[model samples]
Target: MKKVALIASVAMVFSLSLNAWTLGKLGDFKFEKVNDNVYVMHGPVMMPNKENGGFMNNPALIESKNGLIVIDPGGNYNVGKNVLAEVEKVSKKPVIAIFNTHKHGDHWFANKNFQEKYPNVKIYALAYMIEQAKDNAAETWYGILGSLTGNLEGTKPFAFPNSSVDHKETVVVDGQTFIMRHPAAGHTDTDILIEHVNSKTLFLGDNLMKNRFGAFDESSSIFGNIQILENVIAKKDGYKDYKLYVPGHGPSGKLHETLDPFLNYMKIIIAGAQKAYKNGMESYEIKEEVYNNLKDYHKWDDIEGQMGKHLMKAYSEVEMRDF
Candidate 1:
């Protein structure tokens, strides 16, 4: 009898411990304080799927005298709500402005949750991004995420950006100045480059990544990305001292540390693809060759999973070019 009772007690304790751990892990919101009033939640490096609860993207919060401004809030409704829960832990200011860095679903779908709570907050994005999210983009992803999470609770309908900015503009909110620049075709057709003037922090959205690169965006323009990257480099030169860069993924870094390596990687992709095409290689042959050759760039980040996909896309992109 005592042996059975001991086993039962152990089982009960273990069950309670597991439940506590699950709740604490899910409810926790980890954020990094980059500069004064600038807090960034560098989400899990894993992609948004069943395991991570559709959490990806470096969602940031900027507390200004006017209110809290959230950048790339996240990819799902719960993702944004959890961020808000964290915001409450730090500042009591209401979120006044929400900005979507680019058109990628990872950066914008969470707007629904924010809008439901703060309907008055001005959500900003490129006109195209806003329109798509309100229409097909978010709807398509919502279904995928639903299937992935089994229609997980807190996943809400898609929301639209209330304010669409077509031109470069500056807004002073709560005495803090923010400059928005359009990096057309850089990472995507709908990309925004935001300069948090007060903190000298540049939010590059998906335009720049650090430590490693994510999937190659087939929807974006390689040449256009190069042009915008060059422009961004020049802009970096104008800065008096080192400035912090909040990339869409990975860690925040300085321009030289983050942007320069990415520029080199982009150039290499173009050059490698063109060279493979000139070799009279068929598409299949080019993909195999490029996949193996690009493994050298693992120094930049793990390209094992993406190299095969990127090679196929790069080959087609270069094949279409006039050269």
Candidate 2:
């Protein structure tokens, strides 16, 4: 009886230690390889809240010759630790690089953990994003996620990306090549679409969302978002053929299902906004009519709540272009 009790205690301790870094509410998630040497862990579609532990971004991993590369680790420190743990399951090699898609806290706050784990790892983001992080972006995100999750206690704004990348720059690390594309401001002025040249996969950050309505913040441009999507689809600006598309907040799939839906949504919003603006209709008055047309997006996360805000931004873009 004594021996059995001791063994049971040891097993319990092992389990507790194993999960010491576990923080997310979404249970049992692992990076699923979507393409050769490319893996993505699609996070919950819902907005960050106390239940989800501030994890609502699709963190990805890329296996290279010497080490792995991470994209958008997660929203906070605990979540970053969990992301690192998942990376270890696939490769014991140190993370050689990280690419933050934009300046959103949900996408890059976890950068803190990666830097602590791999001191030499180089984190990359758009120059604009790096600038924002250096400014008040980090502190602003810390407070935002802290309030949203209520559990982001240990996370801080300490580890902003150390390196800056630019549009159309080819970055080579660990025998892998990534082409950064930022034809225009989309999700935010800081947005960058990372194309893994080897795996033929494109990581469309918050610029493209699947089954979710992303925000059009002050820095965001709906017209610009549409132009980026159309350019990629038409293979313009060297965005040639790709096998897979990974969105910022949803599943990875081919262009038809992964990229087109959101593109179509933005198009509908802009067209409606243009027509409404010409008629001199108020944003609130036009959103309901537009919402009725967005029947297909009715099931998308937060569409109803985000509809008014999206329309206002769309109207502004139309107003800017016409007058």
Candidate 3:
């Protein structure tokens, strides 16, 4: 009798500890149900040196009558698992679709996990993203950088999208309409925008970030990104007063309100690049010259290094092309 009582007490303590662990970890995946059927999963902060926090960015979950739709599954499979666990707690509906914002690992690395779990669900992305991932399968500078920085353990092979949209496509599911618009080359060659018509929410992906400057690297075009922003702003009515804009890397906020700062930053970068290009400045020279001017901006601390890298790449790409 004494031995049985001791074992029972140990098991009870172990069970309580497990429950405490689950509750303690719940904060990491906290989500806000924005409306009747929509829940926005906020991305955690990216720890500068931590492997798991390298590319932490906002991913959204939309629960509709038809099923659940997830946007831009976080940076890796682990992050995706956390997100999935949280999602399951909120709704038992299977993930019917996953819309990848771009080809960046942060946005689409967990796509295969989603496929594995929800075998019947469709995975969607821009045709260009699929092509780029296939074309650059063996040579990804970002993947290499992540590995070096210890952001990732090693390159994990990905499963490309089976279905993709080249142009604007509308998908109606569960009494809600999602408009998927593939914008002209910004952030990446195949960036996509998702508009939840009923919720008046627009997931801008990396095209328009709230506080951070949108990155324009070798895969992106500065002029093109600016034009895309303009187009998004111009189509104000099309979005039904787009109240919430889900950025790929920051908190979701109002669309029109967040446009000015991003536009200003892009304009400044483009102007500086054009001037340097006309002056026949090399990429390194351009980087050195414009670094200070950009660093002086209000949110410079958040974007300086990343923007500097992007500007240099954009300069090289522009120099190699017309003009």
Candidate 4:
């Protein structure tokens, strides 16, 4: 009787612990219902660090009739555990599926926990994303996220996507319809923008951000991002006019407030790069000019840090087109 009582006591403690969980100084995070059955936990906008524990991107959820569908779980194992704990608060149903946005660890590394807990959960991502995850990207991001988060506990990459999704692919899970939209190369070559068709919500992934400036690495194309954003705003390519836009990082909002600002920022960067290219100036030479044009985004997170690289990338793309 004592042994059985002790087990019950331990279970009670574990449940209470999860309920009272706090992530660093960020406090308790719960999934805020954005639309009908759709919830989003907007994580910290700052760079990964010990304080933030590498939790930076927006992890979202869609509650269908029988189970839940998660988008971009989070950074690492423990973060994934915490995410699921928060998930339990919203719905007791099992997470039947997950969709990774791109190849970024911060967005998908948490697959470890989900795969561990729910062995049969079908994790989905772009084919390129799955390839990168199996290749060196997983280990590479492990080191990066570990160092950034000060090697926070259980920050390993044990699991990656098990299923591959493609552009315009319709995935119906538990009565919810998810439409995958692919760009040639936006935030990254592996980027996948998910459209939850029923609620009219489009998950822009890192292809769009609210008020934050993200890095455009070698695999990313400024021109590609601009074209995709233009098409989305114009509702081309059989895309629906979405009622809600959820960025990979930052808050979710309507078109003008969420996506337009970043689209305009991209335009300004490319235009500045164009002016520099026409004048026989280098990418670095146009930094100040582009920065000046981005006055509205000056206060955005990581602008000062990412502006130079963004200008360089935009200039390189412009030069390639001219030649």
- What lDDT is obtained when candidate 3 is compared to the true structure? 0.68
Give the worst 10-residue stretch by lDDT in candidate 2: 19-28
Task: Put down candidate 1 lDDT per residue, 1-323, tens digits, no spaces.
Answer: 99999999999767644543122254434666888889998876545566667775789999988689889888777666776676665678788988887766667778877788888989888788777667676677677667765534665546778898764678777887787777557777778788889998888887877656666565677767777667777764232233688888877877787777667777776777788788877556666555565554666545766656655666778888855
CA displacement after TM-score superposition, residue 170 of candidate 3 (Å): 1.2
Could you arrange the candidates by lDDT from highest to lowest? Answer: 4, 2, 1, 3
lDDT of 1 at 85: 70
In order, candidate lDDTs are 0.72, 0.86, 0.68, 0.87
**Top candidate, metric lDDT:** 4
**Per-prediction TM-score to the true structure, in the order listed:** 0.82, 0.92, 0.79, 0.92
- Give the per-residue Cα lDDT of candidate 4 at 85: 85
Model 4 Cα lDDT, one tens digit per residue, 1-323: 99999999999878866776577668767689998889999988777888878888999999999999999999987788888888988879999999999998889888888888899999999998899878977887788888878744675536789999988899999999999988889999999889999899999999998667778877899999988888888889766788899999999998878878889999999998999999999988878878887889988888989989888899889989978
Model 3, 1-323: lDDT tens per residue? 99999999999767644543132332345457865566777654332234444445677888877588888776666556666766776678888988888877777776767777888777788887888877883247346436634644433666567678766688776677888777667777878888888888888887876555544556677777778778777874244457677777656666666666666777776666777788887656776656666654555334755666666766765676764
CA RMSD for every model? 7.4, 4.2, 6.0, 4.6
Cα lDDT of candidate 2 equals: 0.86
Candidate 1 Cα misplacement greater than 4 A, ranges:
1-29, 147-152, 216-218, 236-242, 295-302
Clashes of each: 1, 0, 1, 0
